[model samples]
Target: MTQLTLDTRSISRGDGLTDQAYKVIRDAILSRRLAPGTRLSIPELSRQLDISRSPVREAIARIEYEGLAESVSHRGAVVVEIGLDELVAIYDVREVLEGLAARLATRAADDAFIDVLERNWQAHRDAVEADDVEQHMKLDAAFHRHIREGSGNLRLSENLRQLQGQIRVAMTTTVARRGGMPAALAEHRSLIDAIRGGDPATAEQVAREHITRLRESLHDAASAERHHNNERRKP
Candidate 1:
């Protein structure tokens, strides 16, 4: 429910064949163009990208290491499927990681960086006011992205980024995760204030609470959906 990790940069045009293949495929997976459990047929992918099979295979190997794909016995590599259980698991990890990111960013972020957070906050507010769902979502995503990167902890940033990248489907696809945004924006405002105030304790608590709040919303929604489906299926 936090990242979709947004800022998904495409593979730049100029790069080595293997790296290019890897990036292209990685981006596709992150963007959900290649959905969970979809087959990654090397020869098919090679033809689609108009590249050789070797590079495609190499790309599969890299993504598998990143937890985006797994090699099945005969099915070859397939994208990882994200269900509610997986979604909750990811949010569980992310809430803690994001709390640390906010706490660290309070100490490390400069005024200029805080200015960026303020600007992003205003933009997000505008998006909410205008009822522009896409822009609101993008700004919401960028808000956390700035905090994570601004944390000045490279290892923490990279670890969260990777965890998010591999499981981003949970962010985009589930209906249960949909109802948290309006309230989440208010929580974002609190987090921004905490960071700007340079209180790491408040920042971490606010950050963790923000995520925990959304987690409850999504869980209730998912439970409702399952109950509805079960009732409808009853003969």
Candidate 2:
């Protein structure tokens, strides 16, 4: 009996109930509050959200279409379970796209955007100090979003957004095992310095290398987990 806790006050009349429901459910999934493979029942969600079943159904459908959830035999829809291999695959594409974003942002960003990046970096430092993984994840996404949006390429930003959603799903499952946050912070500092220096090539290179390091970190984490599991199973 897995309970899905949702804030009922998040939905309101004439507020595009379907979209609202979708956002609420999506946030829950990303936050791992709903968790992987948890059943998403339309009736239950409607009751909890205090909304009509129709909107809830539509929201679930949209989530399924986004690959966030899938239909199982006799179980209706459940949150999708992302594995390490899938996360690595997503990072492969993300590396290229994010590199391009960093290059373009460096070329096009103004002083105001540089200031924003500095502010974002400061907040990220605070999150790391507090050891708030969730807040750190949020700030990390915001930091990337700022760069992609600064790239002045709407299509690229949209594609990255889709990829980011999948990344969030995969990350929630293995984030505990991944212990490269400090390394990531240092890499981000390097990228920001490149961006501030107006060096597009350096920015792109640093960004791509950062992602490569992250992908490697995933392999290291998975390997360590396997070793731990093997030790635990020893007689």
Q: Which clashing pairs does model 2 show?
A: none
TM-score per candidate: 0.83, 0.87
lDDT value for model 1:
0.77
* Best model number under TM-score: 2
* Model 1 C-alpha lDDT per residue in residues 67-177, reported as the tens digit of each score: 888887888888887666566667788889999999999998788998998899888888877878778767877888898999999999987877778557555432225
Segments of candidate 2 deviating more than 4 angstroms: 129-132, 172-179, 223-235
**Total residue pair clashes for candidate 1:** 0
What shift in Å separates residue 58 of candidate 2 from its native position after superposition?
Answer: 2.0
Query: Cα lDDT of all candidates, in order?
Result: 0.77, 0.86
Using lDDT, give the best candidate's number: 2
